[model samples]
Target chain A: MRPAAAPKAIVALSAAVAAPVHAHLVETGFGAFYDGIAHVAVTPADLIVVVALALLAGQRGTRAARYAVFALPVAWLAGGMIGARWPSAAALPLLTTLSFALAGALVALNAKVRDVGVAALAITAGVLHGLVNGATMAPAGAGALALGGAVSAIFFLTAILSAEVTALPVGWPRIVVRVAGSWIAATGLLMLGWLARSAP
Target chain B: MKTQMKRWKQYAALGAAMLVLAPATALAHREAGQAAGFLSGLAHPVSGLDHVVAMIAVGLWGAVLGPPAIWVLPVAFPVVMALGGLMGLLGFPLPGVEIGIAVSAIVLGAMVLAQLRPPLWVAAALVAFFAIFHGHAHGRELPEGTSALLYSLGFVIATGLLHLVGILLGEAHRWSAGRQTVRAAGGGVALAGLFFLWRAVA
Candidate 1:
């Protein structure tokens, strides 16, 4: 076969060759919405941050928990919107990691952050993460509905986890939550190390 | 046409080289999912007798110290150890990681054996200091290709559980005879630590 024709043949054959990848936006054939959910579920770093933020807010009190449950999803969606429109990026390798690391550290410390402070943190984490998630979809125009799916997932998780944590009686249950925070913090630091070691 | 032939020759040579070197880069990914990642992480630390004894000793010592110290020591060690792990991953030089691990075992075990209740801060600092070495070793020696997040989670969880076991063993401290038994166990751990320390140095 001629070289040009060979290239054409390969392109045609590629239709049947499918493989899953760790790319930002993954299409699950279940539509854009499920894809969005899958995106968050598969991404451990994002999941960790989501959980950490909830734990931190819950530790802070009911007021903070309310702020996180509302603020985070909204902020994430807003960031995703900007990211989808934004273009030409390198990597923001550490942004989410830094966010989670800081959040986890606060949870471990059981810091004296107020509800407003917790809300601000949720916004910041949500936006930064949402922007990155949005960037993944921008090139393909992966749609706002997909981002909505992800936001809803985060919102539900925040609502459920923070509520559970907030309602715990004030003794060893609180201590256990703090212990979990320490574990999350340790995981974050380890992740940071892995990134640094793997960085060129 | 002659240039085309040379290109073909180069392509053939490259293909041959790739065939020859493929095995060097190929790794086993058969057991490469999340379960494998977590299980390995959980197993690796406990596999090492040195790490296990020390971790359990912290719990035992905590039980002896009673209440807050019991929880506090276990909590602090992992966090500090994680920092050490970060340093290790970043290629920071930490002299005597192995030695430090061994000494941690000896010191913590001795504390359990003697039922010494040093100030909480002193005990915590000592445990934290030893934790760095353990964390560095863990960070430095992560499996080449695995789910790092799950692996770390498994590791931390395993460490926590081991500490719980020690705390449980120390529960014997509730009774005078049981307290003696716990101290005897501590002495045994300390002796084992000495063996490990000798192995490390020798």
Candidate 2:
């Protein structure tokens, strides 16, 4: 009896240990939307580009800035929809990084562009970013996740742009913005190097 | 003057809260039930000293580098880390994973201690490369039935929060004495890395 009881206890322990681990923050329902937002929010690469572009747009004046505010989300959603239809390309990361680097450099140099140019830049950024978002989205509820990503992007871009626009034109603030742009360029170059080194 | 002092006090309290909440062990455990997804993902990074140290070091290095680096390093880390996680999930093999992880602590800590501000891109590359090792560890150890998406979200958020803490601490650089304190923290991290390296090699 004692020997049989020992085996039963061991079996129970093994069974307990074998139970599947839980991993999702939200396992069902609207959790998917939260998951989508979480995905975008956690992605530093995307956020930086969005902020950098917004800053550049704001610097260009109200029209480019307003266009950015509208164009980015629309382009992002369209890009996501397109990405859902096509396989993710290896070049996408490179393109995104380059876009970021370019944006950063423009900001650093305080370069001015036509409003159309800024709009194009915003659109390109949106599409690239949206494509990445779409690629990661679960197929079953891709739309919900995309909506979340759009919402986050819009909110983030608006807040940053508004702050930049409202802040008084102080010497140090301008310097900080330029410094941020330089940093973006440097980071982008580094990523490109890493990509080059790791490429097969 | 009173308000300034109060602000300092608030920051101090927040720091205290951070220290109190900081996880103590470096062992990963699989959660058995409903607590698994986000909680488990969040636990993964803080559970391991190597992960925590390297991550905090990234933030510290970022702060030291200033401006864009403060943002770039943190951002690049997670995106590249996700790629690494995907590779792990696909069963791709990366050699010297443990060594790479231990070395991350040593290298990142040393960067902080020496105040090595490389070109921003170079720094970002360094942070991104090491992130893969950490992400792989998280991915490989993902529980049997958890949603990979949620788990990824949890860990990313957890990792970002840790970076934020390091960034806040790195803000000590604004003052003269605070710079030394931040560097001292870096030294402590480096020494801990050495210990981890020894344990790994042994």
- Ten-residue region with minimum lDDT total, candidate 1 chain A: A15-24
Instruction: Give stretches of model 2 more than 4 Å off.
Output: A1-200, B1-35
Writing each residue's lDDT as its tens digit, candidate 1 over B62-145 gives 999998898899899888888998999898999988889989888898999888988989999999999999999875566666
Instruction: Provide the DockQ value for model 1.
Output: 0.32
Comparing only chain B with the true structure, the TM-scores of all models are 0.82, 0.80
lDDT of 1 at A90: 19
In candidate 1 the C-alpha lDDT for residue A135 amounts to: 79
TM-score of chain A of each: 0.84, 0.77
Backbone clash count for every predicted candidate, in the order shown: 0, 4
Q: Which CAPRI category fits model 2?
A: incorrect
- Cα lDDT of model 1 by residue, A1-200, tens digit: 75446444544444434443323465698998988887788777778889999999999889999999999999999988888877444156577778888898898788999889999999999988888888776555568888888999999999999999999998889888888888888888887887787888
User: RMSD in angstroms, candidate 1?
Assistant: 7.0
Candidate 2 global Cα RMSD: 18.4
Residue A112 alpha-carbon offset, candidate 2, angstroms? 13
